[model samples]
Target chain A: MSELIKNFTRELPDWKPRVRPVNLDEATEAQLDALKVTPSNTKVSDYVLTLAHDVESLKIRSPLFNAIMYDKGGLKRSERELGAIGASVLNRCIYCNAVHMNRHAQLEKDTSVTDSILADGENAKLSSRDQAIFNFSLKLSSCPPKVGKEDLIGLEEAGLNIEEILDLILSTALFGWANRLMHILGDPVKLENNDS
Target chain B: MDALDTTTLRAAGLKGSLSAAAALQQRANILHLTQKAEAAVLRPKDFGAYNHELRHALAGRICNLNGDQITADQYSGNAGTYADLIDPGNDGGNYDLEQLVNFIDKVATRPSDVTEEDIKTLQKAGVQDPDIVRLSELNSFMAYQIRLIAGLRLFKEYES
Candidate 1:
C-alpha cells in the first residue's frame, strides 16, 4: 500500500476513504440514482461513492459544484480553481489541493503559481490579481472566516468586478464544504498503477 | 420558491442593491441548486440518528462557530432541545452527545487539524458510519452557507 501524501503537489493523488463506501451492488435505489450509475457510466470514484451514503446531498451537490466552478461569464475558470486551491491549502486537504492545483496549472498553462504555492503556501509571491484572489480565499476558508473590507478592497483594486468577486466567493466557500468532507473522511495517497 | 429567495441570500441580507441582486440572479441556477442542496442536507428523506431538528441544531452550531450570527440564528430557531449546543462554550454533556458534539465542533472549526483518530473516536463512541456521513454533510453545508452569507454581506457592505 502506498503511504498517504502529506504535502500538496500539482500531481493528482488518489483518495482512500477511511469509512466504508456504499457497496454499489447493495446500494439503495436512492444511492444508485445519486451515483448516476447507468450501465455505460458505471465508473465512480471511491470519494464519490463514500458521499453516496448521504445520497440526497450528493445528488444536488454535483450540479451546484459544476455551476460554481465551470459556469461561464464570471470569474475565469483558472482563477476559480485558485479560489478552490486556497481553501484546500488552508484546510490541509491534500487531495483537494492537488486536484485543483493541477487544474489551475493546466488552465493557466504555467506552473509557477502553483509551484510557489506548493513551496511557500500563503506567502507565495504571485501577480497582484492572483495574490488578491488567493488571500481572500485563504481568509474565507478559516474558522470565523477572517475576511474584511480590505479583502474586498484588494479584489476590487486588483480589478475584479462584483460578478467576478461573487464567483470567487462561491468557489472559495464551496471548497470550505469540500475540504471538510475530503480531509475529514479520507486520506490522499500515492496514485497506484491499477487504480485506473 | 424564487431562486434568489434562498436561506443563503436571506441570511446574507442581500437586498436593497440592484447590482448585488443582479449578480446573484445571473447565477440563479447555482443558487437554486444551492437551496435544493440545503434541503437535502437539512431535511433529507432518510435522515438516520441525525433527524431534521438535530440537523438544524448541528447547522446552528456550525454557523455560530463560524461567527455568522445571522445564519446561526436562522438554524437555532429550530434547534429545540439542541439549542444549547449552538454556543461553543456549552459542550454536549447534557445530551449524551459530548463525543459527537466535540467531533462536530472540531470538524467545523478546525477541519485541517482533524486526523483519522477523530473519525475513530466517533466510531468508538458508537456512531455508525452512515450517520457520520450525515453529520459531516450537515457540518460541511453549514460551512459553505455561512461563508456564502459572510461573503455576500461583505459585498453588500462594499456596495454601500
Candidate 2:
C-alpha cells in the first residue's frame, strides 16, 4: 500500500515557480516605460512587472493586460484593479487579495471603501454602476455557469452597454483562470514579500 | 430613418464597427460579474468546488429531454454529461455545493461568538442568487446542456 501511494505521489509533477517577483531597478527600460504610461510608481511598477512575468511564465496573459494597455473600452485602472481584487477574494487568494486591495487603496486613496467592498460587495456604498459592475464581477468570479439573461438584464439596467459587459467578462475570466493557476501552483506569497 | 430612428441611426453610425467589439466586451463583462457575484456568496473553503462546478457547467453539454426520470447511463452516449452542472459531487468530494450550503446555513443561522467580520467573510465566500439564479432557477444549465447538444454555442461566451 505504501509503495502504491509512493508511486502515485511520484507520478505527480514537481512544483516550479511560475513567476518570480523582480525589483524595479532590475526591470528593463521598456518595462519602466510601460509603467510610466499607466501612472505607476516604483512599488506598483515592480508589482506589475512581477505579475506580468508570472503571468507570462504561466503561459497566460491576464485580460487585465488589454484593459490596461489597449484601454479596452476605457476600463479605468481602478475598475480593472477592482476586478482583480474581486477574483482574488473569491478564489481565496490571500496574496492576490491583499496585493490588489493595497494597490486600489494607493490609487484611490480610500482604503475604507475598498475594505467595505471586500467585506460586503452588494451593499457597499459604490455608485449604482460600480455596484453593478462589482456585483457582476463577483458572480463571474465565483459561479460562471449561473450567469443568465437576468444578469445581463441587470447590467443593461445598470446602463452598461454590451461592449462594457464583454470587457468585464474577459477580465473576470482571465483572473478566474489566473486564480486557479495560482492556487494550484502555490499560494500567493505574503503581501510584504510580494512587494520586494 | 424617422426622427427617433435618426437618433438611433446616428448613434449606430458613430459607433460603426466599434459596436460589435463593444458588444463582445459587454458580454465578457457580464460573465465576469456573474462569476464575482457567485464568489461573493461562497465561503473561502467552498471556492475550490465552486470553481470546479463553474468549469464543469460551462463545459457541460448534456440535456434532459423528458425531465428528471432519465438516468445518467440511459441517455445516448454523452447526451447528459452536462447534467453534472446542477448535480453536486459524489459521496466524498470537497467541492460539493450542497455541503457548502449546509455549512453556510449552519454558520449564518447559528448563534456563536463569530464577529461581524467573520460573518462577512463567510458571506463573501458564499454563492448567492446573482451568482447562480440563471443556472439553478432559470434553467440556464439546461440551456448550456442544449448548447452542448447542438455544438453551435460559443463556449468562450462563458469564459469571459
User: Interface RMSD values for the candidates, listed in order?
Assistant: 0.7, 14.3
Each candidate: RMSD: 1.2, 15.9
Give the clash count for each candidate.
Answer: 0, 44
Tens-place lDDT per residue, model 1, B1-160, is: 7778889888878855676877888998998998999999988989988878888888888887888778888888887887888888888888899999999999999898899999999999999998888899988988898888888888777767
Instruction: Residues B17-95, candidate 2: write the lDDT tens digits.
Output: 3434345344343334333322322211233224433433322212222121222222232323434433323211334
Q: lDDT per residue, candidate 1, A45-130, as tens digits?
A: 99999999998899888899999999989899999999999999889999999999999999999999999998899889899999
Point out where model 2 deviates above 4 Å.
A1-72, A121-125, A189-196, B1-160
Best by TM-score: 1
TM-score of chain B of each: 0.95, 0.23
